[model samples]
Structures are given as C-alpha cells and as structure tokens.
Target: MPKMKRGSEIPHWFPLDVAGTIYPSARTRNWNYTYRSGFLLKEEVNPGLLRQALEDIHSRFPSFFVGVRNGLFWYYLERMENLDIVRRESTYPCRPMNIFSRQSPAIRILYDHRRFCLEIAHCVADGGATLTMAKALLARYLQLTGKEIPPDSGLTDLTEPPKPEELTDSYREFYVKKVGKPAPDANAWQYRPPQVLNYLKVIHGILPLEDVLPAAKARGITLTDYLMAVYLYAFYLAVPKSRRSSRQIKVSVPISLRNFFPTETLRNFSLFTNIGFDPRAKADFSFDDVLEAVKGKLAAAKTKEAMQKLLSSNVAMIQNPLVRLIPNVLKRRVLQIGYVLAGENKFTTPMTNLGRVTLPPGVAEHVEQVEGILGGSAQKRINCAMISDERFLHIYFSGDTKRTEVQREFFRLLAREGIRARVECNIREEEDVE
Candidate 1:
C-alpha cells in the first residue's frame, strides 16, 4: 500500500477482495452487474447541499474514494483526481460504472425531487456497505439543512476518522484451511421471460411487515427463508411444465459475512448459498414442501463451520502462487471462462434481503422508504432485492422480461394469504427509455 501527498491531502490505494476480482473480468454490455440503493424523502433534494454532503462523506470513506487501475499482476484501486459531483436521477437504476474512464467515479450519487440514489459498481462494496453509506449521506445532508440529528442515534457521523478495521479485507482475517469445498448445485431450470426493446420493468410491492412476518413465523422459519420459499413457488408457477425438466430450482441467497465475522470493513464481504428444490423426485410439490426444503437447505449450508470452509477456499485460490504469477490478460481470460461455466447459469435468480434500515429521528421523520435494486445477470432475466424501514418492506423486481408473471404470482401468493400488496412501475403509456 502506498500513500502520496498532493498539497495537504494524502490519497491511498488497495487491492480488490477475492470476490471483487471477478467483477472486472465478468462484466458485459448487457449485464453490467452493478446495483443501486436510495431512500425516498418527503421533501425534494437540494443539489448544492447534497454536493457538499457528498464531499464530506467521501472524505470519511477513503476506501470508496478511488478508481480501478490495472496493475502488472492484479487490478487495484487508486484515488480519483476529483471526487464525484451529485447529479440528477436517470430513468432506470443500476447503470454500469465505467471505471476505466478517468471522469467516472466507482460510486456516483443521483438526486431528483425527493429521491437520493447511489449507483455503485459492484467492485466497491456490497448491499450492506452501500446502504450504510447511503444512510450516512442522508443524515449528513439533513443536518446541513438545519435538522437536528442526535449523537446517541445509530447514524454514523461524517466527522469521525476512518477506523483501520473498517477498511480491512475481512476474508483474510477470517480464513482457515479446510479439507474440501462445497459442491456446486446441479443445472437449474431458468425463467426466460419475454423481452421488450429498450425497456426494463421494475415493479415494487410495498407490503406491511406485520402482514408478512406472521406467515413466516407460523412456519417456524426466518423471514428470508419464508420469502425464498415464495420465490421458488413463484418460479414453479411461472415456468411452463413442458419446459421444466429434472433440473433443480435454485435461488442465490446472499448472506452478509458480518453476521458470522467481527468486522466493519465495507468492501465486498458477503457470500451466497444457492438453495434449490428438486421437483422431479416428488409428484406433488406443495408450498409446505417448498418451505421445508428451503429451511432444510439453509440450515445445512449457512452454518459457521460451512461458511469458514467457503471463505478459506475462495481466499486460497486468490493466494495461490501459480494464480498470482499469471499475467492480467491470462487471468481475465480464465475468469471469463469460469463465469460462463459456473456463474448465473447455475442459479435460477438472485434474492437479496437488506434486512431493516434504522435512521435517526430527524432523518427518519422525513424518510418514507429505501430500496435495493440488483442488476440482471447473464441469460438470467429476473432478479429480486428488498429493503425495509419501519412501515413497509419494499420488494423490487428488476428484469428485461416482457411478462410480469413472476411478480404477479409472487405477490398474489402473499395477498391470498391475507397480506396487502400494491404494485407500482416505471413504465409510461407511450414513452420508454433514454
């Protein structure tokens, strides 16, 4: 690691984590593989105040105040010449970050009316870290606008110095050697939703947590497990019986590494478990069966001991001497091949739950909702992300598919079970995209 002084400020650079190294090589024009998160405020945004807030926020998070640079061996992050300036919102979310361009920031902020959105390149961080940064930016912007945010509140401050532990690659700290690795899931049946030109449908269902939590509790499973069951059931309904084969139906559930490890570093510090159900074995596959299957798979896969092996295996590959000696050109070629062979094709779709976001009283009063939107994966058309505040869980369905069958079936399942569901989308009667 090297730091340089340009006048009064010193900038720092770092190596990408084991997971992050895949993104630079794996990204394509269609599947940019980025994500966006934002909060809907009661009042409109003030760009001048927001710009100042971003500068302050960037200063506190040096890990994000950098750009991707290709090193002789591996790619690394170097400080950007100019910190990002806030811009207005775009028609759609999760646009790719052109990290190779000197003008672009790895993470950019967009604002329009009452919404403040952060579109982050996956290389910088995952949902947990990105949401943490979003809340901090919001809190700081509100304070600048003459609102009083309490010191005792859980909101992080812009004035606090960056802690060393916060910038650590936690995988390195938590890794331990293991005998074997988890086997990849068998090929799964994919949902190939019909596609429209120049448009991606983003439908959100804002339902009361009170309505959904009970159903999850009644089945003796966590909220995530219950929702995943709903997703699997939804897939079962959407796909034609003729198209479905003996292939398993799997959903990639991203698990936050913070739960098992002790660290606050905001880099890519999460792993996923691909939980699947094999419909071929049983003639009658009920929702109860789906729920039980999900619960069993999660229990077996998400244990601390299991995750330790996973971390160890991934880090071992990155740290391998033969892998390290390979040039960047050859390394990228190998990664690109691996991505196609064992990437999104192996899982049906990705399902991420951002849990709940708690805000300070000042910030909470004006904030109505928060949303996490995942970019589409290759060939895999539909992806789901959810975020919750005090009132409702906002579930976003992001895809280029023409049909809304998955969204319709999933929410209808909830509605039939006594949960209130409302549908909203970004499409107009006539016009579409940019």
Candidate 2:
C-alpha cells in the first residue's frame, strides 16, 4: 500500500477529443507521430520536487493526466491511481506512449541533467497545450523550491479545479459552415535522405535571435517566414540538380486555432497549412523567390476566414454520422491508410515554430534553453522544430539519417547572411556512422 503524495488531485476519466481520436487510430510502428516539448533549466532537476510538481499539476491539468482506454466506438482516457514518477531519460525523445496498458500515463515527465521534458502522445494534446502544462509544472516545482513566481507568471494556478472550458473540444465549437472537402498532398515530392541507424539524430543549432530578425525584416517577412524560406532553400540546395520530379518543396506549418477562436480548451485545437513553391518553375528560382512565395501563402492562410473554413471542414467530417458508425478497428485501419497518404505525406517536410517562449522572471532566471522536437515521417526523412527565448532561438533537426549535410548547409546559409549558429549534436565525433 503506497501513501498518496500530498496535494494530489483526484483524476477523472473522459473520452478522447475529436482531434485525439484520429491519432490513436492512425498511429503505427514506424509512424507514431509523437512529439516532445520541454525546457532546459540552469540547474539539474530534482526528481522528488518534479514528482511533487507532477502530482500538483495533475490535479490542475486533469485533462492531461489520464491513460488511454479502448472503447467500443473510440479510444478514451481513464484516470489511474498512481503516477509513473519522473525518471531519467533513458532513450530518444518522442518515444511512443504505451497507451493500451495502464502502466503508462498519456504524458511522461522526464529529466536528464538540466533538461526537463514532456514526452506526450499526440492524442492527448498539441504543442500549445503541452507548453502550458510544462510552464505550470516548472512554476510549481520552482514554488516548492521556495522561489516566488509572480501572480501572472502565465502558469495555471494548481489550487483551483479544472476549468470546464479547458476540457471542452474547442475545435467543434468554433467551426461553422463547412466550406469544402480537404484534399491530400499525393503529388508532393518526398525527400529520401540516406538511412543510417534506427536512432534519431537531433542537431540543435543555437543562434542569437537578433542575428536573424534583421534578415527577416529586410525581406519584409516575419521571422518564421524567413526561417521557413531558409529551410526550403537548404532543401533545394540538397536536392540533386537532375531530380526535377518534385513539383514543389512543400513545408507544413501548424496554425494555432486559439488565434481566431476564443477558447481555453487545452485539447488539440490547431490546424495546418502547407506553404511552398513549385521548384519545377520555368526559370530556376532564387532564394528570394522561395521566401516571397512562402510569405504570400502563410500571410493569406493566417487570416480568420482561411482558418475558419479549414476548421469548419474538419469538424464537418467528424460530425458526420457515417464517420462515427465505423467500428473502432476498421476506423483505425482506414485512418492508418488515410494518414500515410493524405497527412504528412503531402508535404516534403513539416516545420513547427512555437515562436517566442516567455517565462516569468523567477523561472526565466534559471532557464538556460528550450527546445521542441517533432519526429520524422515515412515520406519525409527529417522535420524541423523551433523555439525562442530571451537570448537565443533554438532550431532542432531530428531524423533517422546520419548525414549532416543538410544541417551543415542550413547553418552555412545563415552564416552567409551574418547569422552565426553554434551547433551541437547528440552523436559522438568518432562514431560517425555515415
């Protein structure tokens, strides 16, 4: 018999949300679609303090603490009695959550040295939701350590009950008037980078935000647009000149649904727009050409009208009686196929920018860096994720390949523009498998 930790909250079980259902149904051995988001603090994490933080935050973020359960119609969440306490990071980031067994929680709080990460299944929440949870956990951990965080530290107070709105599916609420059916990116050219070891090679390129902000401003584009252009251009450089099969070098950028719709639901409430240029244009396109094309597409897609239509169409599909009637097993199979073909396969690669991450002064003082990682897809060998703090903007490149040519070219492009990057990698120098 184990004694419950003090300040622990009663966990409640619930059904998977609209967006969550698709992830569990479509997940596979090679394509789990899992993601990791966390902060690197200035000090080593205390497992005991982190456990307390988890228990405290679980009470506040009940929506995030449950385990996955199989239902007749769909997969659901079941709250468990005990939490799998914070443990040392033993493997790669974004490993699959053992949802079928009660042994695993939907999200795992992991620590290694100064890094405290939240490895979450895509089923429970998106990056934004996870970010909020991470901030709250860090705040509570700091509070326990006698560090006083401000009242408005952007951390959710753990003393209060979970908000009713936070548990609701905001996607179904804001969506209205379905416009048109969504299409797949079957024609998108997928990159086939050389395969190396089974482990992911994550390269973190730390650069000063000031170095690239001016470059983006000079192009009259946002920083994200500028970064996207740099990546697309890097991919262009990596592509063999003779291979002109890919019509466009598409990059999938996720747009947060909270921007247009007003909702505090921590569940998945984001949509994505694939923005890129056709590389097969009559004239060989320059870097500026790619930047301008990406800028135009992203600018147009960010509008309220564009987002509403996209969300509404997705809701319409889920709301369809026909979609709901399919058996869970059959639904899983169909979704697995649909996901491989229409989902990430459409884009040459996907890049997510969490944008600028701000912390309360108390917590910010102890944080060294923050990073976000998205696993690669079947079609795309590597995916890019970005996060920025007060000092630096960190871009992480994760893939199964050993080749650093793309990463080298990417940093070189930045250096060419006076945006110097301090590069670090996980693998040892002598153990170059490639």
Per-candidate Cα lDDT values, in order, are 0.80, 0.80
What TM-score should be assigned to candidate 2? Answer: 0.93
**Predicted candidate 1: what Cα RMSD to the true structure?**
3.0
Give the top-scoring candidate (TM-score): 1
Clashing pairs in 1: 194-402
lDDT of candidate 2 vs native?
0.80
Indicate the worst ten consecutive residues by lDDT in candidate 2. 1-10
lDDT tens digits by residue: candidate 2, 1-434 = 12334334533667777778778777656655678899888888888989987876776777777678877777888876567747799877766667666776777878998899888878888999999999888888888878888887767777677777888888777867746555444457777868654477789999998888888899888999999999988888877767647577888999998888889998898888888788877467778888877876788878888788788877787778997898787878887787767676678888999989999889999888887998655556788999999989999998878777677778988999889789888767786564
Estimate the Cα RMSD of every predicted model relative to the unseen true structure: 3.0, 2.9
Q: Give the poorly placed runs of model 1, Cα more than 4 Å off.
A: 1-11, 194-198, 432-434
Give one clash count per candidate, in the order shown: 1, 0
Global CA lDDT of candidate 1, please?
0.80
> What's the TM for model 1?
0.94
Q: Write the per-residue lDDT of candidate 1 for residues 1-434, one digit (tens) a residue.
A: 01222323433687888778888878765555678899898898998999888776776677776678898888887767576547888666766667766776688888989988888888888889888888888988888888888877786655566667777789888888764686755777777766543456788889899888998898898888999999999888777678887788999888888998988988889987888798886887888889888886777787888788888888998899999999988898898888767776778889999998888777899898887888666566788998889989899998876578888889988887788988888676465543
